[model samples]
Target: MSLSLIFELSIWITSVCGVLVALWLTWRAGKQRDLSALAGFAVMMALWCFGHLALFHGYQSLGMVLLLANPLMPTFFLHFALLFVNEGRACRPWLTAMTRHIPWIYITSIGVTLYSIWVNAGATIRLMDDRPFFVFTESGALNLGYTVLIGVLAHAVLLLGWRHHSGNKRRSILAMFGVGAWGLLLATSFVFPSFGIDVFPYPMLLLPSYLLLLVYGVVRYQILAVNRFANRALLALVMMLLVLCVIAVLGVFSGRVGLEALTNVPIWQLWLYSLVVLLMAALVYPTVRRITERLVFPGAVLNEQVLDTWSRQLNLADSWTQLVSDGEALLRRQLGQTVTIKLPNDTAPSGLHLCIEQGDIGWSAHVEKTDDLSPGMRLNLEVFGSLFASSCAALERSLALAEAERKRLDEQHLVELGSLSASMAHELRNPLNIISMAAYNAPEETRKHIKDQLARADRLVGDMLVYSGKLSLQYQRVPIKSLVSSVLTTLSTEQVSIDIQVEDTLQIDADSHRLQQVFINLIDNGLAYVRNLERGAMCVEAYLDSGRFVCRIHNNGPQLDDVLTQDELFRPFVSKRRGGNGLGLAIVKRIVDAHGGTIVHRSDCGWPVTFEVTLPPDNTEGDV
Candidate 1:
């Protein structure tokens, strides 16, 4: 090939590559307003490259028509920059006004150039050193105007870059470099020729390189915010290119071996050859796709296995600490690196990190030797991180349910033991009372000690029976005020002040004896914990609330300890006060439950301690 033909071919190839890359970028960028502006910019660049290719091929009219799109390129770029900064919202009024007139400016410049061409006073094209170059035959006003317009747009884009750099320095620098390089090339193409320099449009050949830099910015910084569909489209494009390369290679070999026969071949044979090539591509596509996926995403298989194992382990994990430790160990094994897991209050190490959030709980993981991670490995890590978050949430819920079940079973076992002990105590009560009666004629001190021991044994048996549900209630309409008076009269010797707030007519359907026992246990328990017996006070308030008879028994006792607050207060053998069997509240709870009532302890009812009970009311009406 001649030097000029070789140069023309090189320019054509470069233009074709630039057009392909730009079109791909346009398709990948999708339909967001900012991305649409970017797509427009890419289209203009493709048209500009096509125009130069056409000019090299001696298609002057076609080249001029395509080159008409060139002036719009910088305008599209500026629009893209404005949208990028403002996130596709309306920009400053000045910027909006300036952008609105860019098309008019382009039209006016094109009009001047066309008018000059019509009058045969336009720029002339001449062959110098076997290369065609443009030279203005008259005043170079058109070239100067185009150069000035591009310079102004370039400065505007640079300013935008500077403004955006503060928040995203890497992406801003990359965008600026790409835009500046292209602007420099575009300026040199016209400015050098306008200044009487006879160089060809050598800068135009660098269009493909400029496109590569922009594409790098898009891929590295997600400039256009391309989605997964774009990634699949890019993969398809790569596959198509690979197929084309194969066909090209086959064509070259066939031409070398069958040059004479190929020249003599009929049109039908060419069609047949094309059909065979298409058939081969269709058959090879799936196999090629699988291989490419394996090569490009080598961690996919391992990621699937790791995720499956992670899910199973989380399901089986008995505790949060166990789950986190196992997850960290699994990740370390899969990635072949040290991993640090951080809980909510733990300090996070400096490294590449992923955050896992489960409700209000958050865990962060720092990856050691991050430089060893490939793109595929990083992708796997993201999938694993998301799974870890959801799994941790599931594990927490699972563990909570398990603990609740364990506590329920423990309570059931305690109830069974209480029943056995209560039965034994019942059997011993009669014999103990008989012994005390028999010793009635003995020495006074001995008889008195036996009587005290017998009374204590009887009280213990009563408490155990109530706690174990061994005692049944005989429900009757019991007046609230009278019942309270009776219980207080029995314990009147205790130096504690009692306040009653129930009406005389308020009554409830409960076993009067059991109801008295409930009050006696609660009042006596309160007195036991009171800090000052002389000043210690108790209040018994009753009212009808929400279709139930509500009673609140409050005392000025010490607040319950933290340990006692956590499910220990109403459990047998767990006491907060001295000289107590720990069964008073437990028996009280059982009796209330037997009467189909609810009782709960409250420390926030303007009292140091309070027990509120809600019971079914009797049919007889009573005043509040």
Candidate 2:
């Protein structure tokens, strides 16, 4: 009602509200570790309000209370600026050091001012009739030094805000206001009248506009209130309180203001007032909450669900196999689609496909690093990534498991090929040895039959050696034109009209013996097919296309049937030639691939079945 009461009430209420807010904020942050700056801001705010209260309560000379507040007040301003700027986390270590020396700094500074007042007669103070107490100090160099020191510290905070200049304009402006406030307060309380003006007063109101600015950043733009649930509850309370006032007023206006029963009752009157208030509040709060939630919490609940689901999924998935199955199911459930995990193959000698899929989602073959894993999760042991992913995640345990299975199957395949080669080599040798012995013992007429058997044995043994992987390579760059000529010469004796259309001087960097063996296999087949006719056509053509040396060997042979489908023709121990071991063409393919190349068998149907061999041209052979 009165000016003094109003002033007293404003100071007490502001002080109490500020402290309570600070306490709640600080306590909320204490439960977590990362929000140190937030907690620091809270504690600083509390100290700041306490300092303000001291000055406001006419307690300045109560053991130097006003001066005691000086150190913390500036510090709270700096810290508040930091937090408001979203740069608080980076500020504290320096301020912690500042706080450590604050006691000494404040005591020394206060001592000088007090000394000047008591002993030097340079400083004084008085209570104003129209104003509160004021510091009456000089416009001396000491006063300038005080303003400069506070300005330097406050400006230091502003300087730090430069990194966030574009990020936090509000903080920057507020810090400037603080610097101005300190400077103005220094001038008015210490320098203004001494220089000739009655007032140039800048006090608590100078910089605090920025607190409202902060509230705006938080409420409208950043909305940091949701970060602390207390703010939300407080908001709910305010809305409810407003609704209560509205309904109480409406009831008082609509009905009798002084009803006997309502006015006479003591407990009931209070209860009626409270009930009316609560009833009105009930009408408005849910609507306010729904509006706020829509604005502030769109997709928030869904985000939480995702986080919870991921945490649970990771917990439930244990082994690589289980991990894969769970991942597949989870992804299917969450994403409503199937997800395939694949890794490149390294040993397969394919480009960018090394480190092949270890397995599906969860497989035991992956010796996963569990140190960084939880009960339901694993870390990719292959910390190194050699291939690109749709996203850059190490193969999950499920995918790793699938890849492991593939590797095991490849190993088993290699083992089976080994055993088949050994059996074929054994079957070919027995009769060949006996025929050679019999031919040595037989007379001339009988010896011819055994010699034929020995020749058959030689072909068998050659195929056996290749299938067994015992064939040695005489590797060197050889001219293909000359090599093909020799193969044609050997097979030309058969009743075949051979046309050689060759790419001359085409050098291949390969095993001459192995290449010769491959050419012989094709030539021999061509001879067999063409020889069946009284006279049949055969041709061998070699040329280069796209860095590959392509050799086409054709004969007037029957078209290859469906039995030799593209996939089946490459299988070892399956031969198309009569009494021929299936190893020859398979061996030819293996040799070509060993030299960093690929070969595919295709039948060119003319009068003849043409076999095509495509070998990757060597870089060295380019010039040769």
Candidate 3:
């Protein structure tokens, strides 16, 4: 082959090689790849194809063909930089905007170049149509400005975004810049009056090398599953296109060439033919992607590679659901073929059993047993019996321990009750003796004077009996309105007002005698606290609320001392009041709570010093 013919062939092959590689990369990127990145690459490849074909079409000097693609060249370079650095979040808006505007940046840069060509300029706009001697000198102020502006801007953007990228990102972006730099150098050789060199477009070849590095990085990271996607598409599409292309080439070249005959054709027609087919494929990509996804993973959101992925994650149970209890797991790992369990003669099945157990406590287990033994069959009788014996023994020991503990607790409770009753009986003796002695010796006139003391003595004894469960509540239908009035009348407070506003017939299932004591304790505290206050104001009100008998006692007194934390106030013998035995409120709380009533204290302004009690409709009869 002659050198020129060889050179032409290589150049044609080089251009063809660029198309093949670009197509493969895009296909590898697949639908899951960012459409913006794919589209950007597609634009670059399409424009580049135009530039190469224009050169081959004997229209190389116009510069318009390559100019059309100049903007995309920088854009494609920036994309590679991003591909290296992107860690899988959607593309940043600002970076995407900058990238999208790059084609305009290139077109704007070429605006001056095109204007120079239009104006029939002197030094920069030279027209020549030949080889080594026909090289033109471009040195007008406009041309220099144009070249410098584009080169500087491209370099500046590279430095800003790509230079500081760390790790493999830095390496990949640097390679992109290296290829871009060479491309610029080639363009510079063509325009500037620097020298005569046929290597003006030589730097363009380095684009593929940089792209190769990028492809390797992609494969290394398994990025986009590009290698697999690209390889499959290349194998399929190339075979289809080549078979059709060659057939068309042969038919065009010779009308009667046999199917077996190898026919050669021009590179130009092959490119256009391949391009027609490629464009048609590109047009159908959306449909192809949808169809392929449905066939592979119907619900897949990101077009994941099915073969590359595992169907079921065996031990992912940890991530899926918590194993809060010890038990069997539906694991993907292999397991024993059959599970055998030994059971005691007396145990019945319960849910959530052991997979296999053998003991005297009786083995409770889950298993796959499919044997029917006739009366004559001896079914490994000794081995099975031994296993059952151990399980049964373990279960029996555990049950015995639990039963012993329960019995001991019951005995201890009975002892505590006896001790309490004895102590209470002894404590009541002295108070009872004092009241009895006073009652026997006092005359009728002095009896009134001793009444208060006698009543207190009786109250103390009643408390002891209540604690011992010997105090019987005389359950009666006590009208709540009448009850409140009785408490208010009996415990008359000169300094506080007792306001009764209950339903006409709010009856309660209560021993009115004991409830009268609960009222006395509450009213006494209200009187003491209110009397000491400068305001000296207190009010007790009763009403129906939320289908219950609600009663509230209010005083404009200072808050209970912080020493009466709510929990402490509920305990017997614990009180915050200056003069209190603390048993009063404790007994009141116990009685009310035991009757399924509710009480709460709200500490706020305007409604300060309040006691709230609510009782459900009772087990007594009343009109309403």
Best by lDDT: 1
List residue ranges in candidate 3 displaced over 4 A. 10-56, 60-72, 75-107, 116-148, 162-168, 178-194, 198-222, 227-312, 318-624
**What C-alpha lDDT do the candidate models reach, one value each?**
0.67, 0.54, 0.52
| Pick by TM-score: 1 or 3, better one | 1
What is every candidate's alpha-carbon RMSD to the true fold? 21.3, 16.1, 22.7
Candidate 1 has an lDDT of 0.67
> Candidate 2 versus the native: TM-score?
0.40
Candidate 3 yields a Cα-based lDDT of 0.52
What are the per-residue Cα lDDT tens digits for candidate 2 across 278-303?
A: 76877897788767765664322223
Off by over 4 Å in 1: 1-316, 332-378, 385-415, 470-476, 509-511, 529-532, 546-548, 557-563, 593-598, 602-608, 615-624
Q: What is the lDDT of residue 260 in candidate 1?
A: 58
Model 3 lDDT-worst window of ten? 324-333
Highest-scoring model, TM-score: 1
